[model samples]
Target: MTEQRKDILDMLAAGKITAEEAEQLIAALERDQAPAAAGLDARPKGKVKYLRVVVDATDNGEPSRVNVRVPLQLLRAGVRLAALVPPQALVKANASLSDSGVPIDLTQLKPEQLEALVEHLDDVTVEVDSPDATVRVFCE
Candidate 1:
C-alpha cells in the first residue's frame, strides 16, 4: 500500500474512526488515484447497479486498449441529450453515426443525464454488447 493508504489504515487501527468512515476514506483515496468518473457511488431507489459494457477495437491485432464496465446511467444520459438536437437533426445525426457498430437509441435518457451527455458525446466512442446493459465509452 502507498504511504497515504497506510496512514489511513493506521488511523483505522488506532480507533480514530469507525470502519465505515475508514471505508469512505479509502474509497475517496482510490477515487483520487483513478481516472475521472472511475468510481460511482450507490444509486438511490429505482436506479441501476453493476451494469457493464466493453468498447474496444484492434489497432494492431494485439488488443489496442479497452474500457470496460461503464455505467448504464451515463450512457442513457448521453443518448438522452442527443435527443434535444431537433428531431429531424437528431435523425440525421443518428443516421450519420450508423457505422459506429453499436445500437444507440437517443430518446430514452433522463433530463439531467441528457445534459451531461451532450458534452460527453464528442469525447466518447460508445459500445454495448449482447446480454448486458452497460455501455463502454472508449476515449480517443
Candidate 2:
C-alpha cells in the first residue's frame, strides 16, 4: 500500500474520519497518483508495465506465434525525441506515411499530445482476427 493509502486507513481506524470519508479520500488519492504510478508500474491493479503485441497465424498448415513486450517509457521517449527532427524530414515522413495509407501526419505529433495519447492507451486493447491469423495489441 502507498503511504497516502496507509495514512487514510490509519485515520479511518482512529475514527478521525468516517468510513465513507476514508473511501473517498483513498479514491481521490488513487486518482491523483494514477498517472505517475502507471509510468512506474507501481500499482498492482490496472497498471500497465509494457506494451504488448501478439500475433498468431497458420502458414501452409504450420502454426506460428510472435509475442513482443515493449516498455511504454520507450515510446514516450521516442515521441519526445520526434520534436528534435527537422521540419523537412517530418514533412517527408508524413508524406510517406500518407502514401502507405496510414493517414497520420507526423508533423502534427506533438510530445504533449503523444503523452496524453499514451496515457489514454493504458486502458485500450485492440484485436484483429481473420481466418488464418489473430493480432492483439494491449498494455500489461
Candidate 3:
C-alpha cells in the first residue's frame, strides 16, 4: 500500500471520513497513480462506468428524444462470461452477428483487450446529425 492509501485508511479508521468517502479517495488515488505505477505509457486508463447514447429528433413537427445508459460493468461481465461458451456456440454467434452486419469475431473478445479499448474510448465522443435527428455516443 502506498502512503496515500495508508493515510486514507488511517483517516477512515479514526472516523475522520465516511466509508464511501474513503472508497472514493482510494479510487481517485489509484486513477491518478495508475499510469506512473504501471511503467507503461503516460496515458491514464480510467474506468468507464456507463455507456451513454442520446438522440434528439423532430418527427412530423413533433419533438422526440431518446436516451440510453448501459452499465459498462455488464459488458465486462459478459466478456468474462463468454469464455465459458462452447466453441461451436461462439462460431454460430459469430455467424449470426456477421449476418446482421456486425462483422465482429466473438472468439477474439478478450477481456484485457476490451478493457484497453474501453480505456481509449474514455476520450472519444461520436456525434452525427441528419435533417431529422442528432445522435451522440460517449462514455461517462
Report every candidate's CA lDDT. Answer: 0.61, 0.89, 0.87
Model 3, runs deviating above 4 Å = 1-48
CA shift of 15, model 2, Å = 41
| Model 2 agreement with the true structure over 35-102: per-residue lDDT tens digits | 97687785556768799999999999999999999999988887778778999998888899889999
Candidate 2, which ten residues in sequence have the lowest lDDT sum?
Answer: 38-47
> What value of lDDT does candidate 2 attain over all alpha carbons?
0.89
| Ranked candidates, highest TM-score first | 2, 3, 1
Cα lDDT tens digits for candidate 3, 1-140: 89999999999999999999999999999999987767666456677789899999999999999999988777677767766789899899999999999999988877688777765766789999999999999999
Q: Compare the candidates by lDDT and give the number of the best one.
A: 2
Q: Candidate 1 residues 64-102, lDDT tens each?
A: 444455455566665665556776775666666676854
C-alpha positional error of residue 124 in candidate 3 after TM-score superposition, expressed in Å: 1.6
Winning model by TM-score: 2
**Candidate 2 off by > 4 Å:** 1-45
